[model samples]
Target: MTKADLVENVYFRTGFSKKESAEIVETVFELIKQTLEAGDKIKIAGFGNFIVKQKATRRGRNPQTGEEIEISSRKILTFKPSQVLKNAINEGAN
Candidate 1:
């Protein structure tokens, strides 16, 4: 679901004001971003872990012009689901 949907659900479940719910959601996102920027990881029980990974520079081709180009190295964020979450989804899909 979208961010707004999540905010609404939280507000209803906790009886929090819309403003407070929005702030809570935004704060969570900001903390996640800050942690990633600091090259750290976040793990939540029964959910997942957010990790930062380094990518090496590589050669790539320009799709349109068919020209070779050097792709610069960069850091990327990745998420690995917890076993509990994986099992929950798998059970729901059956």
Candidate 2:
């Protein structure tokens, strides 16, 4: 779901006004962004961990032109779900 959908869920569940819910959602997202940008990880219990990983420069090919190129190093964000979440998902598949 999109952010708007999440805001709506929070509004209904927390009995917060739409504006307040929106603010809360936005603030949470902003905080996550700030933390990741600062090279920190966020771990939410029963959910998952957000990690920032640095990738080294590598060689790649331009798909269209078949020309070789150097891919610059960069930082990427990744998520690893908690065991609780993994178990819950697996249970649902049964």
Candidate 3:
């Protein structure tokens, strides 16, 4: 779902005005962004974890030219869903 959908969900669930719900949703997203920027992980029970991982520089081959290229090191964010969430999703799929 898009951000607007989240805002609408918040508005309905919390009895807040649309503007307030939007602000609340935006604030939550901003906080998550800041946390990830700081290289911190976020863990939500029964949901998943947001983790930042570091990768070292490596060599890779360009598919088209068949030339060797250096891959720069970088930090990446990854998510691992909790077992409870996995089970819930599987249950729904069945």
**CA lDDT of each prediction against the hidden true structure:** 0.96, 0.99, 0.98
The list of candidate 1 runs beyond 4 A from truth reads none
Give TM-scores for every candidate, taking all chains together and pairing residue i with residue i.
0.92, 0.92, 0.98
> Cα deviation of 81 in candidate 2 (Å)?
0.6
- lDDT by residue (tens digit), candidate 1, 1-94: 9999989998999999999999999999999899899999999999999999999999999999999999999998899999999999999999
How big is the RMSD of model 1?
Answer: 1.1
lDDT of 2 by residue, 1-94 (tens): 9999999999999999999999999999999999999999999999999999999999999999999999999999999999999999999999
Quick one: best lDDT, which candidate?
2
Which candidate has the top score in TM-score?
3
Q: In candidate 1, how many Å is residue 59 off? A: 1.4
RMSD, one per candidate, in order? 1.1, 1.1, 0.5
Tens-place lDDT digits, model 3, residues 1-94 = 9999999999999999999999999999999999999999999999999999999999999999999999999999999999999999999998
Better of 2 and 3 by TM-score: 3
- Residue 64 lDDT in candidate 2: 100
Off by over 4 Å in 2: none
